[model samples]
Target: MSREEAVQRVAALIKGIKFCMLVTQTDQGRLHSRPVTTQEQDFDGDLWFIGGKDTEWVHDISQRPEINLAYAQPDGQNYVSITGRARLVEDRAKLEEVWSDFYKAYFPEGIDDPNVQLIHVDTHGAELWESSGKLASAFALAKGLVTGERGDMGSNETVSLE
Candidate 1:
């Protein structure tokens, strides 16, 4: 596919996946990853996430914004990786736009809570693979039978690195 097509496909995949691993850098320069719920992206490719202001990751991103995000299906046969830089946005209006019931479980007080913070991950680009995107399960199964690999699996990723 053309580069533009690939980029659009990647974004579509992102819209389909709700959870991702947000990777961030520690002070010692080591990488750390945590599961986070992804909300939406702005026109400039800025991804939105909600977290606590005093969280380790919030602090990490403050010092190191370079990051990556990953997503995949349950079967582990499909996955995507997104590279981005993150910055904190204090816009309550933006959070209001994306907040959902899932987030209510974490923040009963909602987006206006003093502890809540917004993370805007600036997506530079992404790469993806879906084992069943083409309905090629039978073919993949045959290949796996020969190669001794597993069946359809899914993964989605969003991360940060030093």
Candidate 2:
């Protein structure tokens, strides 16, 4: 798919998913993942997240900027995996723009909290899988078993955002 189309598709798939697993590489070269709140905003090859400057993930990102984000909506059978580079940002304006009241739970001092920080992810590529629905998927599997042929389970595509 075209780059623009690919980005849009990923955006649509991940829309309204309040949380995603942010995966980063630790100092030991092992992978670490944590659930983080995804800022409510339009996706445009860039993602914003709220985090703590003193967090382990933040330290990992400082050493290795490469990261991955996994978004899934099991009920809708849509999943997206995005590869990107991340960095800690101190953009006060952006922090305010994406700020939500729910974040007060983490940053009791509001956006002014000294530990509050922003993570900016510049995505380069994504892979997405979309299925029709639970019923359709079940039918496809049954058909495959009966006919001894591969059934059309869904559409899976990998696209470049860069």
Candidate 3:
């Protein structure tokens, strides 16, 4: 697929997914992953996430900027894996723009809370797997089983975001 089309497909697949697993490398070189709320915004090769300044993930990003984000929509059988470089940003304007009252649970002091921080991910590339639907997938699998061939599960592609 074309680069732009690939990006749009990814955006559509992850549209309503509220959270994704953010994976980072610890100081000891171990990979750690945690679920984080995805900021409500359009996907355009960059993603924004709100986090706490004192969080361990923040520290990991500071030490190792390379990170991975995994987004999944099991009901639709769509999954996206993104690799990128992340940095801690303190952009007040952006913080205010993406801020939501829901975050008060974590930053009780509001947007101005010192602990509130932004994680900016500049995506380098992504791998996406999307299925036609459950019924189609089942049929394909059944056909494959009978014919002794691999099932056409779905479209899988690796696209460069940069």
Candidate 4:
């Protein structure tokens, strides 16, 4: 697919997913991953997420900006893996731009909280896999059982945002 189409497809696949795995590298070089809500917005190669200044991942991003974001739609068997560089965004206007009530549960003090911070992930590239459905999987299984051949799974592609 073309670059723009690829990004659009990734956005569509992740639209219904409320959360995704945000992976960062610690000072010890170990990968740390945690669930973070997916901000409601169009995926135009840049992703925004909320966090706290004192949070470990924020610190981790400060030291190492390279990161990965993984999103999955289990029922549809659609998944996306995105590699990018992350940085702390302290812009008040931008923070307010993406603020939501769900965040209050995490930051009791609300957006004004001294610790509140925004993470900006600049996309590098992404890989996506999407299956047709259970029927297709069953068909694949039956095909394998009878013909010993794997049936068509679905579509998979690697996209570059750069």
Candidate 5:
């Protein structure tokens, strides 16, 4: 598929996914991943997440801006992996823009909470895998068995956002 088409598909898949695993490297050189909610908005080749400034992941990002986000929609058999650079954003306007009631459970003080912070991920590139579903999966398996070769199981593509 064309790069433009792949970008569109990646945005679509991400829109359907509510949560993603945000991976960051610790100062100790170990990888750490945590589940983060994606802010509700158009993808636009960037991702925003809300977190506390005191969180370890935030600290990790401060030390190492390079990160990865993994999104999976098991129901649709769609998966996306994004590599990017992240930075802490303390903009109040942006905070109000992405704030939602769901975050209250984590930050009881609301958007004004002193510890509340925004994590902005500037996406560089992404890899996506979209499965064709059960019927197609069965067909692929059968075809593989008959031909003794790997059949087309799904669509996989790499998209450049930068």
Candidate 6:
């Protein structure tokens, strides 16, 4: 697909989904994964998230910086895997902009808490897959009839494109 097409597809996926699993390398050089609150996608390959400073992910990412972020539909069909280096951003203004009702369920005290943090992952690459196979593909066709667009999925190098 063309650059714009790829981006549009990624944006659509991000819009339809919110939660993602962020994996980071620990101090002892071990891989660890955790579910984090995804904030927003500017559709420019940068994803925003909020987490705690004292969290294990914060410690691991602080030392290694490298990370892998994966998002998938609950049915286990559509999925996106992004790899990149995460940079910690502590800007207060940006924090309030991405809040949702779900966040309060996790952090009731909100962003002012010392543990509150934001992470920006510069996605260098990604592998996206959607199992809209034979059975589901037909559903996509029907949806396209109404929406005027088809759901196409696969993987690509977001980092190399730069």
For candidate 6, the per-residue lDDT at 15 reads 67
Candidate 6: clashing pairs of residues: 124-159
Reference-based lDDT, each prediction: 0.73, 0.93, 0.92, 0.90, 0.89, 0.72
Model 1: per-residue Cα lDDT at residue 20: 85
Q: Model 2, 114: alpha-carbon shift in Å?
A: 0.3
TM-score computed on alpha carbons, candidate 6: 0.75
Model 1 lDDT on a 0 to 1 scale: 0.73
True lDDT of residue 4, candidate 5? 68
Task: Compose the digit string of candidate 3's lDDT tens values, residues 1-162.
Answer: 676886787789889899999999999999999999998898987899999989999999999999999999999899999999999998889988889999999998998898998989999889999998999999999999999998889999898888
Each candidate's clash count: 28, 0, 0, 0, 0, 1
Better of 2 and 3 by lDDT: 2
Model 2 agreement with the true structure over 15-93: per-residue lDDT tens digits: 9999999999999999999998898998999999988888999999999999999999999989999999998998999
lDDT tens digits, residue span 1-162, model 6: 565666666666666566788899887888888887677546677777877788888878788888998888745466777788898998777777876666666677766666677877776666667565655666777778889986543233442313
Better of 1 and 4 by TM-score: 4
**Candidate 4 C-alpha lDDT tens digits along 24-119:** 999999999999988888888899999988999999999999999999888888999999999888789988989998999889999998889899
Q: TM per model?
A: 0.75, 0.96, 0.95, 0.95, 0.93, 0.75
Model 6 score (lDDT):
0.72
Query: CA lDDT of 96 in candidate 4?
Result: 90
lDDT of 4: 0.90
Task: Please give the ranking of all candidate structures by lDDT, highest first, separated by commas.
Answer: 2, 3, 4, 5, 1, 6
Q: Mind giving the per-residue lDDT tens digits that candidate 5 earns over 1-162?
A: 565666687889889678899999998999999999999898887789999889999999999999999999987788999999999997889889999999999999988889898989988899989888967977999999999999878989888888
Better structure of 1 and 3 per lDDT = 3
The runs of at least 3 residues in candidate 6 whose Cα sits more than 4 Å from the true structure, single-residue gaps closed, are: 1-3, 40-42, 74-76, 134-161
TM-score of 5: 0.93
